[model samples]
Target: MRTNALSTLSFWNTPRIGVARMQSDMAQANQEIVTGRYADVGLALGSRTGLAVGLRQKSAELAALRDSNNAASLRLGTSQAVLKQIQDGADATLTALTGVPEDKRAGVLKDMAANRLGTLTALLNTSAGGQYVFGGTRTAAAPMSTYATSPASPAKTAVDAAFRAAFGLSQDSAGVSAITEGDMAAFLDGPAFQGLFAEASWGTTWSAAGTAPLTNQISLSETVETSASANAPALRKLAMAYVMASELGSANLSAAAQGVLTTRVAGLLGEASKGLITLQADLGRSQAAIAAANTRLESQASLLDAQIMDMEGVDRAEAKTRVDRLSTQVQISYALTAQLRQLSLVNYL
Candidate 1:
């Protein structure tokens, strides 16, 4: 007859092993319950893990796009506000020019235009989030230069030189009184003088902005220009109007010359106001487009969240149940192991 012998050491090790495995299962279940996700996404998703990873990556990209779009929207809104201020200033100046008596026009309009030009320069050089908002693609630096002479402003110097070359006399010279309305008109409208606000000359002196505005990716499929350049025709015209009204020695000009200068300034201001309104409309459209893109992004994000949850998220109730059962099994295994350890030869004696 053959007899089977049970090893006490093997008996002691068996329940200890079972308890260790049950504790590990309990820890896994507890984690799943706490996090509401599978403890190991790859292990749970297996062959479809790549799909989950791709979806999560795409979702992250969408989130990034939405964040950037929000920033672009803010910048656009700020730009629009500044544009409104500039338009208002232009309108107000035109009103003052037309309404003020002829004798008072030069002094009042000159002082007002100078102050407004400074304000406009400050506005164009406005910064948001450490970036100059009106700098087109050149956001790191101020887009507009101050209209001043002390620091030898490039724009001021250029205008002064152009005036001297055209009339063979400085702006403040008494010879300005001799300039016929025809000469003033020719200089203001001709290539020689109008060229100062042309794209090349404006870029060379008045503006540091690029011709192309800054663009933003509002969504996976959509991109929009989110900035304006100081060198845009509307802004250039406004600056030119201010410079002519304030810096051309308008106060000393004969009444006939003043009339020509004021008429040109009024025309430029009107054109600038119209162009600025058009710009605002374009930005308004961009804002609408960005808002629509964000809506689509939110919907896509929600769907992706649902799909990711299906792949990686766990059932909290089921995980809690598993934790409870594992806890009981581990407790029983521990008790049995303790009882086995207490089984001594002295107890059998």
Candidate 2:
């Protein structure tokens, strides 16, 4: 019988082709599985890195916000402290002006001087983080310089001369000037006083004589008045009262003058006291605003972190599951490809 060569060829070639194709498909499937596994690992790593980066960024932002809040709070605290001192000084002056005997006026004046000096020192020498608070842009220097006279006279000629030159004002025998308590209160309310709290520059210069050498000026000192004649309003008023009290002693002043001076002193004190209250309120508000801003910034940073986590964080359990599935698929493909490679036409026949 004639051999069906074509049939044999068909049988051998067809199965061989099928097996080779299957092997190629299996190889591709195996490669795909490995690629998928590596992709999963890469994605997981990327997610982890992203999360870490986000957390670090948020931490830095929060720290900065906290620092800003702390700084604002410190400023508010200092302002409040200074305001309290001013209030106390004003109160002392008020007390001295009211119903104190002339003979006792000297002691009251001395006390007032002490209070003024103390407040001035406190204001001028105010500091934060080693920087002067009230020295304006010139933070390195004390706002009030030391001034003394020879023979220990009550007069402060050196201070008066400096004040006149710095502020263009003349002094009376007591080195006091005609500045009123009301004027002082107004001065504190002005931009110059605000600048002190804000750590900004003041516009002009002031003298111990309570005169502004420049058109606009802002400064403070303890020596409102001395034995030398300068026309400081607060000091002059105090001195006048002291003199009246001393001259009258047990004797009372003319009711009219007494009434006028008393009313004037009381009005000035009331105005100054009110200003303190207002400034304190402002400081409280500023502190609150800063705290609010800090809170907002922190919240925003946290939200950003959460968003970053969502974008980058890995699902560990899912990744493990995918790895396992890909591993099994690879094993199956390898086993099937090996089986196909072993198949032969002789075995089938």
User: How displaced is residue 308 in candidate 2, in Å?
Assistant: 2.8
List residue ranges in candidate 2 displaced over 4 A: 1-63, 102-107, 136-141, 146-267, 312-349
Which digits, one per residue and each the tens of the lDDT, describe model 1 over residues 1-349? 9999987899899998888888888889989988888998899989999999999999999999999988998899999999999999999999998898766677777888999899999999988888888999999989888877588799888888999998998888887988988989999998977999999999988888888888998989888888888888999999989988998746668888888888888899999999999888888888999999999999999999999998899999999999889888888888898899888888889
Mark the 10 consecutive residues where model 2 has the least summed lDDT: 213-222
* lDDT (Cα atoms) of all candidates against the true structure: 0.89, 0.45
Query: What shift in Å separates residue 7 of candidate 1 from its native position after superposition?
Result: 7.5
**How many residue pairs clash per model?**
0, 30
lDDT of 2 at 129: 58
